[model samples]
Target: MTLTAIGLAIAATFAGWVASLGPLPIGEAREVSTTIVDRHGKLLRAYAMADGRWRLPVHAATEVDPTYLKLLFAYEDHRFRSHAGVDPLALGRAAVQLATRGHIVSGGSTITMQLARLMEPRRQRSIHAKLRQMVRAIEIEHDMTKDQILDLYLTLAPYGGNLEGIRAASIAYFGKEPKRLTLSEAALLVALPQSPENRRLDRYPNAARAARDRVLDRMVEDGVVSDADAAAAKAVSVPKLRKPMPILAPHSSDAAMSSVKNKPVVALTLDAPLQQSLETLAHDRAIALGPNISVAILAVDNASGEVLARVGSPDYFDDRRAGQVDMTRAVRSPGSTLKPFIYGMAFEDGFVHPESLIDDRPIRFGSYAPENFDMTFQGTVPVRKALQMSLNVPAVALLDRVGASRLSSRLKQAGADLVLPKDETPGLAMGLGGVGITLQDLVQLYSGLARLGNVRPLREIESRRGEEREPERLLDQVAAWQVGNVLLGTPPPENGVHNRIAFKTGTSYGYRDAWSIGFDGRMTIGVWVGRPDGAPVPGIAGRTAAAPILFDAFARTGKLPSTLPKPPRGTLIASNAKLPLPLRRYRPLGELVRTDGERAPHIQFPIDGSRIDASGGDGMSAAMPVKVAGGVLPITMLVNGVSVGELDNRRQRLVDSPGPGFARLTVIDAKGAADTVVIRIQ
Candidate 1:
């Protein structure tokens, strides 16, 4: 009786020790690959885990093919669903085979046991490790469902070097997902995890084929597959090479990963097919452009402000061109890409009409002299013609009329990060690429024009919540419409259709950057082509280098160019003659001409360097007296470069004061001669 009591005590101790072993490490933290997918859930790019393994997240019940699963179950663990984890019949058969054959025929490790071994990897294979795996397997079965165990196995199973999951193996070997594997592919995948390194298809194709045939033979004997199917699958050739994983939009994927934290999957507002096409387009064009040249393209949906596709560089691996740099966000000279905004600002100021005649002659603002791109001038062209031709002098002149600071502020308000040189303010030179802007900001600004003046911030990540933001105004609706209409008439490149897309081109100083940005009714695309190192590519002009690619990218979007916004309310549709006399022609500020006994127009009151107390002491601005002695009568008065109105008779008038700080007051007469003075308003 004492011996029986001692045996019971030992049994109780053993049970207690087993219970103290605790739960298996099935729920322990394991690194998963960070994946960036497109809007349709297509893989764009994936990063390896911390240990340099490609363990992609898998949903075994849905993401994996059923044939592969059936083959796996048949080959690895037939009673996987029925057994608790350790299949007793299989283990007993393995023991009997070992005894009869005098050698181990099969260890009879179930899929759950394999998963447990993978979770707690051991270097030395021993009986102790096998016993631990069996215990863990039973514990895993108690903790997880069949599907969950299958998923963990699918995720952690090693298929080759640096590839730990079916998804990674499929992408590397077959260049596709494992959603619909062929018979041969399914068999090969089923046989890979047994001895992954030895059966690596890229290194040992013959061994891989032999192992795959074994799986096929077993499946046939088990009646899981027909004899004909097994023979056909075995006859198929094994891949001798491994394909690189998907790396589309590498820059965008990197950016998304940097911004999003702790997430295994990142969904972006990108369309995979479109992104792939544009990346190809960028690569082809960069190759054609010459050595050390790269291209960047960004496409945004006009209505939703979602970035549909973004190609940051021609080739992400090309080191000579600095191809990994995201040129879409690079701050470089914008050339005349900002001209449309200048024209839009002029239209909003009410002093200029599209049909108004303007001289594209040599113009000077202080020490700054602006000239046309061809080193020649077109005298007295209509405002529409001047902008469509992209005349540097005309744009600069209009920018002088529309205060440079105001233009910079307006663009900034609309969400463009304009970079100026150190200690330098916005000037007329900015109209001709003296300042810096990025392709993304440029495209965002153009989207405002397509949206009829409201700028929507571009969104890329799908999980980002929309913030409550005030309407971002790039221009009034009528002004935006006018700018779009003018750009719509800009001539297209050779073999390009006219009036379909409203695009503008710009070549920065010294040809360092070539830019072309365009918009249809639904989308806006911006392109930049140059050496990412900022080295000048001589003779590479925007119209020749960038415009063709722009057209081609729009074509490759697989849709025709949609129409631009229609004329909004209050848009002036009139001829040059029909316009008001004051709006009949544009007159530059400080036009200094003294001919035929007519002195140049000059500002007399509120003189330069003078201070005027125009704030009526109630925190409101009062009228300031303005007097001019000039070459001609009916002189136009302008405060801060925007037309207040034409000064009335007596060559003197009182004008409403502008806001505090320095204000530029100017007067232009009937003869176009003008004068300006800067006064501090208090």
Candidate 2:
């Protein structure tokens, strides 16, 4: 110790001793709560006050783990129950050791003194230090309950590194809850009060491990844990070292820190594990896509519109290649991902429905006429099908039907960031996502669908220093589900899986940029892989490559509930967009013939000769029944080529069905022929 620092310590000690009878000082400094907690309130990170504040209820003393509390007592002050804040014996021993050996005073201060020091101002030690420490210690003993003091200590102690308190510190190191921690882990955390930075688990894993083990051994010797338990804990894998994205993990992010800095923290909807999972996935993707092109992966919890993880770049510290661009928050062109927002507005405007049809053939909007990726045409189709294939012409066509001016206004209303040239770029083609947007915006926009159309901005930081806002609805829940239907399904252009996912994909002009944005009930993820300079990265296409990543990232982020945040009023149909209730009636040709016997004679065969039936199991069809030979014999059929029918042993009656030759016909002849016979028996 320096002479001045030593002198200051001695003077402070005497001052503390003299001041013990009066008001003891309490450090009111707001130490960071470094507790790492899971969505379920389990601790994940172990250690510190730096960037810590997670949920710590005012009455959270009950949830405080006994083992962790005991550890604070054992390490900070072994005789906490009897001490009057300052442990004279330990202090005297510390004094001897320091004067002789030089270095840390070891475990001499009582928990009260440590708490006093924590809440007090930092200063070089002096003779007055002992008096100051003693006084503050007495004040703490007088003012707080053992549990309250314990809670205060746990909430204030500094674990090595930026971790300040137990809450933040818990997840910071061990990747589990403090209450759930093994004796060894709790002891390791206790050891951290001396120096978190000097004992970073990641930077100095060996030292941390040794210190951690020794703490465990101490606990075992003190009867805190059985030798067998200590041995078992040691045998367990060294719980994860550092938080997943410490550089950006909820533990390290400015946003996460600000959320809990001022008050008892609450559990945030953000998932560190999910975020870490996405970051790893994104880094690998950035590497695979090659150098010069950086990729950002963003995952949003659909139910709450909370963004779980955002991998800003390939590697945050890697300056040359993956500079600090948080693609999730940074504004960028979302390409087609922005299309759904327009759809949401249109849905609100009552211009379309899931089954509403539109023309996909190109039509000029001023100087710009949006072309399909293949430059092909699919004359006319429903809005639902257009969205299914992400057909450009149909989307622009629907936008025109909704009117661009209203569309723009609605986008602003829905919280889309509209930063574009006054008149350039988006002609009628803007609906096809010619308009630019960022991944964050896309996630938020999809959050409308994800959260039932209540599109709130994806906030990186919490609203209040200590409070959280109740989630608001942005889009109609029904419409959001409808939109969800559009984003996910069989990976299109043909068939993949009816694998239920709802998302939108976009490939920009010249194929330079490709984006896929959407969400299921559980998560919303947006992937943008392209050149930052506006030039194209070769071979990047939305469905072909980008969508897969979106798919992978979304699937990997964990499944969540599909509750839709309430949608803004009027955006959804109160009853599912007036969809047909699908009231289907089947006439055996016999029923129809019985009702309209006069017309029954117009049939090529008698209605009585045929047994009636219908297909399209969901009652999506009106019916048509046919009769062939006498005794309701077998019928020849060729439906699109494949034939199917029966009247032999399998069936013996004139078959009454919606179709005898439609390719999807349910039945044919004994040869299983798709009926070529297109006659109506009725």
Which candidate's lDDT is highest? 1
Off-target runs (Cα >4 Å) in candidate 2 are 1-25, 28-30, 33-79, 86-109, 113-135, 151-245, 248-252, 256-267, 301-303, 321-323, 340-359, 380-383, 422-426, 450-496, 560-682
Scored by CA lDDT, what does every candidate get? Answer: 0.88, 0.59
- Please report how far candidate 1 places residue 215 from its true position, in Å: 1.1
lDDT of 2 by residue, 355-447 (tens): 665667767766877877778988767666677777787677656644576556556667777566566744555565556677776677776
lDDT of 1 by residue, 177-275 (tens): 999899999999998999999999878989999989988888888899999988888888989999998999899999999999999999999999999
Query: Candidate 2's error at 238, in angstroms?
Result: 11
For model 1, the run of ten residues with the poorest summed lDDT: 22-31
TM-score of each: 0.87, 0.61
Give the per-residue Cα lDDT of candidate 1 at 332.
93
Report the backbone clash tally of model 2.
100
